[model samples]
Target: MITEQIAKDIWELHSRLFDHRPILQGHIRAFVKEFEEKRGTREEDRLNKIKTQLNDMTDKYIPETETALDTFLTNIQAKVKVAVEVCKKIEEKENNIEVGFLDLQRQRRREEWDVFMQEQFEKSAKVDQDMDIEMKKVSAEYEELEKKIEHISTATP
Candidate 1:
């Protein structure tokens, strides 16, 4: 459950980063395009005005883009840390549950040494196998998530 929540949070952060990236890119592209188009125009005064407007837009948006990128990175870092912690907690919980099951099996065997040993052993073995499988799956998922987060962190827009 915690892993799922972490995944969701990470995905939401990824979505927000992508959403902001296109807006920033569009603004920058527009400023460049207008500046380029006005460069060869015969109207000096109009060209100067357009250049000034483009500069102003660049000045405004560059800082905003930097800040947004910083915020996005910080958010992703925090979420990844949280996800790692959640995975650790889940591993701990699984260990505790396994131990508890072992104790229950011992108690069951003690209560009826001959009657239920085979059934209990088989049940316990099956559960242990299932838990092992689940742990492997969770580990693989966590690894994949970590890789994705790393890619997101290092990727250039």
Candidate 2:
């Protein structure tokens, strides 16, 4: 098929690019040019052909299968059931992985928030202690001034 042919071509190109020995600049340039040409040529035509073939196969095969004998119908039905089950399993696994990843992210964020709150609390406590010390010093100085005023007023009398 075209897809199989494309896969083979891609593998061939990959093998050439990843050779064990040192690759020359000239070889690299040649490969790049070849790849670009292949990519640029007839892409639209190739895609259209693929689409047309798929549509044709679907239109041609499905109704014929539906109207076929019992054995053929049974086989197609079995294949379809298997396909559906496999798809459902894949979807379930994907959902599980997503849920696990989200839970991990939430836990990490919670830890970060806890650390931030602890740091802020420590800083606030330090500020409060500093303010308390300053208030005590001011109060002592005020008491000393009051004692001096009392002594002065008694001596003048």
Candidate 3:
């Protein structure tokens, strides 16, 4: 008789547990939903904080980066300008050197021509002097021969 009562109590407990399963499941689902919502909220808050920090960093550094880049570009431009000026100076010097060389060459050629003309003038003067001396000698010899012919004619008469 006692065993029979224990078996009846056990069967009633099993029936109650089965009847409450749907309610327990509903509560578990509600708890899970609440937990998921809280987690999502925390994650959103963390992400928003990261976004704000990133925005602050960009705001703080963007102008500095732009200023540095501008400074670098200005320096490069200045250097380029200086380089161009230096190149022009170098070109001017080179041109001056070339012109000076040409001038020197022209002066040397002029000097050479002057020396050659002086030499030719001296040679022509020497030739003219020699021709004049030969002509004078020939004229004196012709006069002596004419006098001899006249004397011979007079002696014959």
Indicate which candidate wins on TM-score.
2
Every model's TM-score: 0.28, 0.44, 0.41
Candidate 2 accuracy as TM-score: 0.44
> Predictions ranked by TM-score, top down?
2, 3, 1
How many clashing residue pairs appear in each of the predictions shown? 0, 0, 0
Query: Which one wins on lDDT?
Result: 3
Superior by TM-score: candidate 1 or candidate 3: 3
Candidate 3 has its poorest 10 consecutive residues by lDDT at 14-23
Encode model 1's per-residue lDDT on 1-157: one tens digit a residue: 9999999999999989767877889999999999888775758778799999999879998889999999899999999999999999999999999999999999987878766787899999999999999999999999999999999989956
Model 2 lDDT per residue over 1-157, tens place = 9999999999988888886445676788899999889887779779989999989879997777767856687898999999999999999999999999999999999999999999999999999999999999999899998889998988896
The lDDT, on a scale of 0 to 1, for candidate 2 is 0.90
lDDT of 2 at 61: 79
Query: What is candidate 3's lDDT per residue for 1-157, written digit by digit as tens?
Result: 9999999999898878777877889999999999999999999999999999899879987878899899899999999999999999999999999999999999999999999999999999999999999999898899888899999989996
Better of 1 and 3 by lDDT: 3
Q: Where does candidate 2 stray beyond 4 Å?
A: 1-87
